[model samples]
Target chain A: MAEISFQLLLLQLMTGLALGAIYALLAVGLSLIFGMLTVVNFAHGAFFMVGAFLGVYFLGLTGSFWFSLVLTPLAVGAIGLLCERFLVRPLYGRGIDYPLLLTFGLSYVMIESMRVLFGLEGVPTSVPAELKGVVDLGIGSFPTYRLFLIVATAVIIGALWLFIEKTRYGLIIRAGSRDPEIVRILGVDIARVWLIVFGIGTAIAGLSGLLAAPTRAVNAEMGIPVLAESFVVTVVGGMGSLPGAVVAGLLVGVVFSMTSLFAPEYAELSIFVLMAVVLLVRPQGLFGKAGLMG
Target chain B: MSNAILSVRDLNAWYDRSHVVQGISFDVNAGEVVTLMGRNGAGKTSTLRSIMGMLDKRAGSVVFNGQEILATPAFSRFHAGLAFVPEDRRIVPGLTVRENLQLGLIASRARDTTDAMIDEIAQTFPRLKERLSQEGTSLSGGEQQMLAIARAMMAKPRMILMDEPSEGVMPVLVDEMFELFARMKRNGVTILLVEQNVERALSITDRAYILDQGRIVHQGTAAELLADDEIQSKYCAV
Candidate 1:
């Protein structure tokens, strides 16, 4: 029993890291949007679902997985831009209630529209030829695709970090999050900055969806549970801290996976439990700056 | 439009429903250092904010460099050669001192073609040169004030509206700030300064405007305001 449990723990650890990559990608985008516009972005999961759908369709159209991988997120990002300009922009500074409601409504529209078109059946996305195998890691065997997810997520996050820290425009984004008015006074077209940020954020969510579609069943309702989990990660990591999102993502994933190892029935509930514990102790989150949400 | 660097006429400003500045007018001509003197709650800060287009509700005409910019947005005003150094400094968190200065250069009305402005500002503020990599908010109160002014200068603005640059600063730094203002004036940057330090402000500025309860009670040469005891006592509390 002990040997079996140890083997399960190792396997689950690998599973948790890949799951954490997905959560990190989604939560980071959510955090970016929150950081810039202070909008909760309830439609983010819908964007993810749409990206998965777009990925499947694009693969069908071009007969090329690579093209689908590149194009889907761009399409979703454009959709996000439209959402911001038409639906969300008017509600800015009127307090958070209107944006929150608008996004919730948008998420409903996206999911229902997809359901109408694609039905409630789960669509299986074929794994790419390059990633269609398992790797023997001495202790256990892990899917090569899952390892790819972990690596790809890391590369994308590294690029994001470099963009925010090394580039001049990135500086504006960081500074704008702290005090947008000052950024405007400094002469940046803050509206354009926000539009681009919103687009990038939603695009990341879409990318996460596309990446995850191969592992999970692609259905209209696929994003619902993930959305709940992403929110828990966001709140646990702190509202707008990028590093917080990452660490908290991995931590939540590991906890959930570990819980499943022993108490499979309690796996899903473990995330909320961890969130409550973290909030009770450090309300600002591990990396969140104080007074941002309060 | 008037030929002044900045011209304000009958400016009234409010803070979201509460009218703060009522029927005030002022102008800063080319190459002149102008100061607005008033007591606490005298709407001096409101007047500066109105000029910057930072207030939500502001009425009347404000012309900069021969164009009326009352309808222009706050950011466009900066592009139109207006810069405001707010009282609180507003040093952005998570940025180094150098990065903060770089933001000023990026936001300027005209691009710094040579990118020599940063070096020039560093030379002017030697203390800033030493702490270029330090976090902006980690600086001392006086250093942050210096950073604010230097950041404004990085824009190479034709005109700057500075509000209470001396607050929370040590006395020695206050002297350094005044000296820097004098240097800024000598370099042909038009300035409109708001301050509670009546004596220090009057000494550096060419002209002075005294605001009391949202109105300009006195506008004259700095020497004239300094010489007048009653106006000083009534409006400035000096």
Candidate 2:
């Protein structure tokens, strides 16, 4: 009984980490957009769903998951670019509420459009052949795809960190996030920066969705749950903080997975519970600096 | 007029409903350091902001480099060789001093010379040379002011609109800043300065405009303004 319980614990921990990885990716994207543009992206989940759908569609056309992985984010990012230019650009300096409401409405439009195009049925996606199966560790067996998810998220997040810390454009993004007017006066076309930031944010969402496709049923309403969870993650991690998102995502995931093992019904509820507890302890969230957005 | 690098005429600005800068006109010639001196709320800052295209509700004829640029955006103004150093010295948080300096070159064609420019800036501002990796906001007020000015110089702009560079700085550092401005002036960079330090300002300035209630009350050469005690006592006692 002890041996079985230990193995179960390890399995649950691994699964939890995989789930956290996805949440981190989604939350990081949301935080990045909010940090730079000061616009809470309500349509982030919809972008995730779009990414999955695009991935599935691309896979079907090319019969290659790798192609889908590489192309989906680019395609979805282009869509994000258009959305920013047409929808988000006009609302800048009008305060945050306008963009919030706009993105809220945009989420509905994107969801309904997907419903119309793909129908209400949940489209199934298959795991790539190489990633399909289990990897036997010394202590236990774990799904290979879940491991890949964890590794891939780490790599992507690492690259993003380096980009933000090392590159010149990244420097502008950081400075612009603090005060765009200063950046503008310094000679950078801040409008273009906003557009590109929006693209990158949604592209990250799209990649998360593609990663989630094989694990979850791909449907119009699929983003709704993940979106809620990601918001919870964002709040728990402290809104608009990248590192906070990452740590909070993994913590929420582990809590969620551990709860599922003991009581399946409380698994979903556990994430909110963790958020509430974190909020009670630290109102600004785990790593959030107060008055940052204000 | 042809030699004037920045010329503002019939300029008016409003913040929301309050009409702040009312029909102010000023000129800063090429390779000249001009001071805009006035009491608090006299709209000296507003005039510079309007010229930089930072003020939204502004209408004016601001000619720079022989072109009318009242309609141009703020970034484009910078691209056209106009730079601004705001009074507050907005050093971006979470970015290193090096990264902050790099922001000055972000949208300029002079980005290719980033390393050389940074090296030159480091040599000029020795206080910031060792703190390049430190977070910009962590620097002292004097160091931050220097960082702000150094960042502006990275673009190698033809002219700079400086707002109160010596405000809230230590006495020694204030002298250092004025000395740096003198060096910059010698390098042929035109400057339009808005300062509360009237005595120091006139010392470095070739010409000066004294603003009273959003209008140019007194305009003269620095020597003439220094000698005329009546105008100085009325508009620039502070």
Candidate 3:
């Protein structure tokens, strides 16, 4: 039997946290879309992939990382907004199943379109000059880009939290998620709210894609595994709970990282086991309210 | 017709294919409390919802402040000085009382004056004043009804369409709510009310319309409706 090493565990923990940050970003967006619109957006992964490609294209056009970072989400958000207004809006009141099926089809279209445009090979993303080095911690050294990703993700999540908690629109969103019929009767333009929510959710997914570009090999098939992973994180976190998504993301990331360190074969399997345990014990997910699942 | 603040001409409403409110017509003058009284499923609630543009399959004319509004949507009707307080008293969960009131303000393009409106609402409903920070779902049944009314008042509406304000409320709160309605009428806010409590509704309303099945069977002064026990027995059982 191999002896446990504290140093190795610490390194693995750091990697897990970094990976969890990305998952949290993806899962929170999914939760918001599901909570507010009740649409299981299978197209979310495609949105992320498109965002990565857009980020690369925007960088090529502008030669500025800052511009791509800002523009990628906006561009993807517009597409999402259009989709909501034209496509998803009609499916509402028909049933939940229609939107789910529509999004599934949308995902296939996005993937195929990207394959046609970007070709079959994975695109490489270069780390910016300032972030292309090692950061020396007191105990160890780590890549600066990885550290930047962790910090950037934290800042983004914090900002998102503040927006949802403190803003007028956020209050409406929270209330609407529970009872939209009441919200509509109160004289609110519920159609507009739905559009904005879907847009924001897709934008965040796209932003995650852009953020992941430098860390992963960007290809047509990249979105599938990540989409499945995001679903696991969302379910484990308690569907539609922002804080739940954050906690579960980090937990899943750490567990996957730690498992890979010890038994590489069981790395992916660990996430499913945690999900199964959460399901058996608390079917509502970690932070989901009781009686809300139906 | 010219003096009336709200006029409904042959108003019809439906839930999908089910024609619920059939040819219901009524009118309310400015600053008057008008009641629509009926038994269960007599289309009284459907009449109110149709006037507010809440029912998509609704047809016929709703003229508020003398502008034809049959073509208007629900939210747009709100901006035109109409407010609706439904029977359910839909208090949003996870939102404080103050936040719920804020939603009312958002509905009628009254968001900019939220602070002053909130202060007025607090002053109007003393029961809601102390519990402004409490989650809306935590309130008692009567208090929740009061909050729903107070929320509608946030719009500073010219008129309010209320559906069964007395439902599930204690007698004391119901009396208090009627008194509040009287006070609102005195202050120049018109009301179109729906109620199952025929006796209590007659005491406060100037005029009453008794609906049967899906149409208005009787319309008269509140005193006339109260005095005519025969009309009451035919349309309203209680």
Candidate 4:
């Protein structure tokens, strides 16, 4: 039997971080939308799945990984705008559950449509040449793609933080998160902000798909499991807190990694179990505000 | 007088069918200081919210500066020269004082405004000048209130709906806030203040409306309401 050792733990940590990077990206979008628009957007996972396929389709057309990387998200973001404008916009200022149900229905429709075209089997993707090799780690070899994934997550998070903190539009999003009424009173057509936020959220989901496409087999139902996991990440972090999502993503990733080590089959069950534990303890998740729970 | 700057007639509002403001009507004339005064839950805040389109559900006509504005969205109302200073201050807590003011300017038709106006108002609210580089959350309550008003001032609005300018501040700050309002009035910015502080509300306002159960129960000049012991005790007494 392979005894648990420091190197093994280190490997798990690295593995967890890689997984966490993807979860963090996906959850950030969901948290932001909930924060500003109070919409659950159940279709968020479907968008992620759609993005992966988007990469497959775009790469087939352009034969360039980089081109697909940029365009897939933009395409997904545009679709997100249509979703928000047509379905989510009407449900604003109403009970949040409205968007939850509406987006849930949308997710079903989107997934079914993709199924009719792509079939149920997962599609394969190749790692771009630049990211295909393994870099020698002092302890063990690390895939260059995994390193790229880490750096990509960092760069994306940093850019998003800068956009929300330094730019004028960022101020509106932050303000809108707290009190959309005030955002409007300042004379911004908040509807536009909502559209932008929805686009950005879906774009992030798309990016997650593109990032993971080379690592895993993509399929019509691929977004479903990730969707459930991202929701867990978002809720455990906080419904609308970006910081909350990052922390929760890291926590969830590490937990799942460790669980797979102890009991491989239990890895799937670990996420739900942890979510239950969090709700039992903090109730509002880690960074989530208590007063806002109602 | 010049068709009144903002006029509301028989406005009814709801928060998902929970009637909050029922058939309330009041008007703010051009460059006038009007107020809606009542106890908490008496619908003074809701009335202002209804006029600003912040109420979840509201009905009846709201005319602003000769235009029918009842159906207008909140941001559009700002473009038509109306501004609303929320009850909670709603200062962008993470932003610097200047940034918060800049955000307010940018939110509306920013093309017409300039940083020079920010500098000018920053001069008026000296507290804001001192805190210009500080995060909005770092300021004291009074300073936050000043930042809120200074932000609105940057937009150069024709009218502002100020909700409880005196709430949640020090007495000295409250006095200074009223003084600031007086200064704003002299500058010809139309205002509609909503306050539970009847004495202070009456002191600064030309006319006052007493709201109760979402309806207009009393309407008269500020001085007249101040003298009426019965109205003050029954409706607006703290």
Which candidate number would show the highest TM-score if scored against the true structure?
A: 2
**Better structure of 1 and 2 per TM-score:** 2
Q: Model 4, B1-238: lDDT tens per residue? A: 5558887888988987789988877777887899887778988888888888887677899999898987887788878888888888888755778778887788655634657787788768877878788898788887788888888878888998899878889999899889888988998999999988888878889998888887888999988998899999999876
Summarize candidate 4's per-residue lDDT along A1-294 as a digit string, tens digits: 578988778777777888889999999989988888889989989999999999988998998988998999999999999999998999876898999999999999989988888887857788888789887766577788987888898899999999998787887888777767777888899899999999999999999998988888888888889999999998788788899898899889889988898898999899899999998898898899896821
lDDT of 2 by residue, A1-294 (tens): 124477778889999999999999999999999989999999999999999999999999899999999999999999999999999999998999999999989989999999999889957788889899999976688989999999999999999999987788888888889899999999888999999999999999999999989988999988888889999999999999999999999999999999998888999899999999999998889999875652
RMSD list, candidates in order: 1.8, 1.5, 1.5, 3.0
Model 3 lDDT at residue A45: 91
Q: Of 2 and 4, which scores higher on TM-score?
A: 2
lDDT of 3 by residue, A174-265 (tens): 87888787777677788899999999999999998998888898998789998999999999998888899899999999999999998989
* Model 1: per-residue Cα lDDT over A70-133, one tens digit each: 9998999999999998889889889988898999999999999998988889577978888899
Give the residue spans of candidate 1 off by over 4 A: A5-7, B108-115
lDDT of 3 by residue, B1-238 (tens): 6789999999898888888999978889998999998788899888888887778888888889979988776777777888889999999888999999998877655588998999888887999999999999899999999999999888888999999999899999998899999999989999989988888889889999999888998899999999999988888874
Off by over 4 Å in 4: A3-12, A258-263, A291-294, B14-27, B38-43, B92-99, B111-118, B132-141, B209-238
Model 1 TM-score is: 0.96
Query: Relative to the true structure, how large is the alpha-carbon lDDT of every model?
Result: 0.88, 0.92, 0.88, 0.86
TM-scores for every predicted model: 0.96, 0.98, 0.97, 0.89
* Backbone clashes in model 2, listed as residue pairs: none
True contacts kept of 4: 0.81
Predicted candidate 2 versus true structure: per-residue lDDT over B45-142, tens digit per residue: 98989898988999979999999998888889888999999999999887889888888888888798888899999999999999999999999999
**DockQ of each candidate, alpha-carbon based:** 0.78, 0.87, 0.68, 0.67
Fnat of each candidate = 0.81, 0.93, 0.65, 0.81
